[model samples]
Target: MHAFRLTVLAGAIAAGAGMAAQAQPATPAQLAPIVVRDAPHPLDASRGDAYVATRASAALKSQADLLETAQTVNVVTRAEMERQGSTSVAQALRYTPGVIAQYGDTDVRHDWLTIRGFTPARYLDGLVLPFGARGYAQPRIETYGLERIDVLKGPASGLYGQSAPGGLIDMTSKRANGERVREIELQLGSHARRQLGFDLGGQANEAGTVSYRVTGVGRRSDTPYDHVDDDKAFLQAALAFQLSPRTRLEGTAQYQRIVSDGGGGAPALPVLGTLQPTSAGTIARSRYVGDPDYDRFTNTQTFVGYTLEHRFSEHTGFRQTARISDVDTDSRRVQIGLMASPTQAVRYAWAFPESARAFQIDNQFHTALTTGPLRHRVLAGVDYLRETAHFTESQLNILTNASGGYALFDPYAPQYGDFDIATPPDGLNIDQRRSQLGAYVQDQIEWDRLHVVLSARHDRVRLDTHSRQAAGTTTDANGDINRTTFRTGASYVFDSGVAPYVNYATSFQPVPGSTRTGAALRPTTGKQVEAGIKVQPEGSRALLTLAAFQITQDNVSAPDPQNTRFSVQTGQVRARGLELEGKASVNDSLDVSFSYALTDSEITRTNAADTVGQVGNRMAFVPRHQASVWADYTVRSGPLAGLGLGAGVRYRGSFFGDLNNTHALRPVTLVDAGIRYDLGQASARLRGMQLALNVSNLFDKTYVANCLGATGCYWGTERTAVASLRYRW
Candidate 1:
């Protein structure tokens, strides 16, 4: 089956390349080349004036043309996000290729997504968010402060230490870009949502050597889900200074706060919410199943960072980037437990309070030189990360007494009480600190039409954790480990503008657990081989990529045989897939993006008794087939020349909901559409005024978005609409 898929992918690539070659005749004048010594980095081109990007830096950590790189990289420009009226990171990624956005459904606390069936790491600028491990705390970033987002596909541990094999998402914050910026926006939407925001930036000094930018947002909203209200505020400021022609410095600071009703509560039965209405008196779609008194979540985050760049010589340059961040969250909610039948369910109170402080630094040196006919771009870097986290949890017994839950009441008519629970003491569960230091080197060699990239890195990681108990004594769990990772790839560009490439990369992630012998287990390791074709036809603003890959992970944890409280490393998983994506600016009036992915993910081996017979079971939350298409059109050279319209459709194929393949979620399709009118050309006074409206799930479909098991199912969102008015200069 794998061989057949590969053959089909290859044939598609060949046919695409041939069609591109035939579309444009190759003439001497059209193929004429020009070389300049002081051209700007390719990354600068990706931050273009439009929505279509042709270059990115996330894959190589340096400005490079995407067509020349031997990997898949997708760029979501700020223009694209604004056009789609995206309010969250997950919303911005909905149209991106090869990404499963908002798979967690109504969980707005974090931007949950998957890349190629695996969870990818999150990065701010170039530093890792460092969450999702034992007791690690991650911050939810507001999308209003971002300038752009870059998605790099495939394993990247060879450059960035300890990352998932699938890929990573890197966000670039808004900063002073030397262009004057002035914008103000007001938005109103369904569920009584209201927002006010502004952005202002320009030169800060008469000498033109200094610049500054500031962005702020305030929002108050309620979701379609009953009683789930959200209030948020965000502010960001950045400054830039050009000390000299060869030296420059930039600094940034941001603060954000969010108060809301706790995350979404899944249904007690997988089939009750969508497949059938709850048995208790017509469960309205707006019913609130959770307690309104105990449901609350609050989070606060602060970030400060700086970047310094200097040119030592014509052939060499260096940059240093550093950041310090703090995140704190407090949450309490009443969650539904196992269902007794269709209308009755057990409930329990849950609370969690966590805080984390992290610091990171990266120093890199770059040199571009040539030897004979081979041109080389070499990069060497060192990075360090330090994070400390404190967390505590408390549970209220609410399963035995009638006051604890609605044992038989209707789900649509929830009852609430004033009973209050005491907050848990800090450090009652775990306190941990993690530190990592890594050094890496990479070289990109170009000889004619062929390009080769080689990179290697070594990381030294240390963890010190203390488990706390009510008896006042703490147990220390400390460990240190070292690892080496590498990556190599080569690509050749043909006359038809098609580049065929192949790559091999490795990744490692530390797992927090012990064996029966009281020894820390080794980190999980992953390896992958990917081969693909990339095409960027000449004289066209379109890009196409076709790739197939296989990934294997070892040292996965399973239940320990000797000790029931600990775990052992005796499990493995394999994921293989094919992806095809295309993004194009077909003409001055039309733009389109499309993607399709096929993922086959399964647990290959394990020693745990519960999973011994489930080696072939499909991985949880990952669908077998996913596809999406989006297009926008604007009237050109007509009376409605400034008017635009957009529409998209997303499809997710059926898949198992659990690792054991015991339950399956049905396939679903969603539609989205938008309309906008620009008033800039109408009159001098209205030159910068515009109005737009967007709708998601236009058909108001009712379906199960995801099911963790028989008792944990999330309903997809119903139809939603947002309208906005903005003025910009």
Candidate 2:
């Protein structure tokens, strides 16, 4: 199977290259004008424009320029997302290289992602998502109201504080861009799914001083199960005011709600004796046990920011930015299923439920000073966040048949089972709060052909916990943790259009849970060493980068035997990898982008005797090899003028399920294709209207996305299709 997959991938690459060679050269008449826009602030002049704005530098530029960053950044533009008919974040990232999306169940609300071997830290316009649980689960944020999605790989701790060592994702909101626009869309598709959305944005005055945008989305759908369903709605609005020629202010507010009926399957059942058949008939009985489970998740977020720029003289100018935000989230889930059982066939039936409410406030300030022959940018900020997590559970009793199968519940019969049964006082109402105070500074030095960056930060975090039970008993816990990190890097540009750079950076993560000794474990520390080469031919439309890096972490935690849910900080791990990424626009008629990663990770030290021999094992869910390629061609002349065709393929190597490397899931390949036709009519109602169709997993491959330590697992999605239409002014 692996050999066959490789052959197919090789063939596709060859075919794409051959097609590129046969493509006709674009002439001046066929070339689209590339217009450049001014930076939001004078200090932002040094930063590259991007097609999808997310990072601090990119966010200040025009929204459409986010695709021009020099780093290995990928953007899912609104146009592409609509064309692909993406309903969720996972679906949008499917074709992005070095990104892995794993769905534990069929329901899309519980989906999660891992990028560059690290879990994603969700953000909105550079602000942290207010409510993040330990399991990487949060209230679903609808994508319908977003302008674009920006994915930044590598440590962004220089700007964003308390982040994962891997990277960060910023969801840019739709805002008024000084244009009058209004549109409505309706979609009906498989699974009895229906969706409706409307967008409004434009200037309210002739002076272009006042502008606003409002967006709303609602969806409903039924799954293949008997009682499984999904419902969601979202509304967002933004207002912008121009204070003067050199200053501006903007404010935004958003609200979202998600409700789901327990319909998807549960984690895979253990295969203790023998492997089960692959036929759908053999797996039909593996249904989600929480037949009556129901959940509601809601989020409210608001932000207000201002941008200022002034020129003290012709050679000197000052730029300043400030922003404040508030976010709140509430969630509740009522689950009815089998919690646990020694034997797989006769699991006990019960009801387990949970809820959480979180709130946060953040503020940031930045300034830039540019003088003759010297430029300095300084960033300083303070962040404070507080969250309260409440949990409750109860046990229920239900009779079963002799064959270990129970009769289905009759919805009409209210007395089929005991709905109010009490269990022991094993659960508690817990309130946890975290306060973080941080400050950072960075300086960028530019010489004749050299650029260097020096940065450092110090963060102090305090955690407090208080717990109470229904009986009025209470317990309290408190701890403080602090870490200081720094990074230095330099890039040298040559006349030959080649640039070489190297960097060394450090990161630290505070262990959330307690240790075996009842003492709070210290923060885990990590260091990364990387070197890379970048090439961009003069006046050419191509960019290439190759980087090799090694990362090591010390004081990693190992599970404590006394506490089933906690671990002791006494382990170490290391990872090394090589990455190659590039983009080429052969001309206005053709464009291609590709990325490949080779990663190896293992446990270097562990306190557990049983895990000593697993030093060479691959890390869980970390594939050794991953690659993706995308290409598109636009017809220059003929009846098919302005028509475009696109196709891409993604491949992931096999990976282990446990630290011991005892079990493995086979690798898989996914393919996507898209086509777009432009209906040109400058004055007609359909002016610049485009129609697109996309198909994913064209071969309909079946593979496992994840497994639960040989006990349970999940399978990837099957083939899917989406069609869409868009009109631009």
Relative to the unseen true structure, what is the C-alpha lDDT of residue 558 in candidate 1, on a scale of 0 to 100? 78
Sliding window of 10 residues with minimal summed lDDT for model 1: 12-21
What TM value does model 1 have? Answer: 0.91
Note the residue pairs that clash in candidate 1.
none
114: Cα error in model 1, Å: 1.7
- Per-residue lDDT of 334-394 in model 2, one digit per residue for the tens? 2323213222332233323333344444444444456687654444455555444444433
Per-candidate local distance difference test: 0.75, 0.56
How many pairs of residues collide in model 1?
0
Write model 1 residue lDDT over 51-166, tens digit each, in one string. Answer: 67777778888867677788888888777787777788888887665677534346556677777766788998788874623432577877787777889888899999988788
Worst 10 residues of 2 by lDDT: 12-21
TM-score of each: 0.91, 0.79
Give model 2's TM-score versus the native structure: 0.79
Instruction: Identify the candidate with maximal TM-score.
Output: 1
Cα RMSD for predicted model 1: 8.9
